[model samples]
Target: VALALCVIFNNSPVGSAISLIGMMLCLAGIFVLQQAHFIAILQVLIYAGAIMVLFMFVIMLLNLKQGENEGWASREKNLLLSVLTGFLAIGILYKISQVLFSVNMDTPASLPDSFGTVAVIGETLFTDFVLPFEVA
Candidate 1:
């Protein structure tokens, strides 16, 4: 829904960026519901926070006015772009269907005892990423 709203608010760059951030937050919520706390946090921090700030900064810097190039494209160019977009959409749908049909929908196996635990994560982080962890 938020993604659809982003498209609907395409005329306003700031509004579209806000809706895109909303979509990112929705995805983060989904990750939380799936018991992926670390991924959810990273999603919120990286995408919704940093990337949205950058996007908004760029949008403000551009200072684009509405309908600045409303009549710039000729009818032939519009038709060509429409056809290209259609083909791209068709290709994406085809790829999605292929993946859907190929993958099994079976229930996943249970997680191990130490899987996703704080102790295990901390130990691995300290061991494998000692320099980076210390640097940060």
Candidate 2:
């Protein structure tokens, strides 16, 4: 949407603002899916709620209009760059999905007694390097 605002939509502030809202909503959804409910609430509250209202105020304060520009980038160059970027993004997404789908999930029959206990971590940190710990 950022690219679309700059290139396709010719830097329309309204379009950019809509895109920002959409992006923030998606981010909040991702946070919720990841079980980070608090962060998701914060994302919506801080970004979509407060920040967006502030952005709209700024945009209005600037008194922007779409018709005139200060000789922005050429449409042809922007189109070319956007196309190349799209291709690169597609390739990266493909690679990432391939890696993610290849993960193997296996559960061990028995667990270590102190796999992630705080005492075990404390012993490793304090006993293994007491001098370094004290120096820090």
lDDT of 2 at 28: 89
- For residues 51-87, what per-residue lDDT tens digits would candidate 2 score against the true structure? 9889978988898887765554678767876797798
Model 1: per-residue Cα lDDT over 77-97, one tens digit each: 557666767887899999999
The candidate that achieves the highest TM-score relative to the unseen native structure: 2
Off by over 4 Å in 2: 1-10, 67-74, 105-136
Question: What is the overall TM-score of model 2 with all chains considered together?
Answer: 0.55
Clashes of each: 0, 0
Can you give the lDDT of residue 69 in candidate 2? 57
Q: Could you estimate the TM-score for every candidate?
A: 0.52, 0.55
Deviation from native of the Cα of residue 45 in model 2, angstroms: 1.6
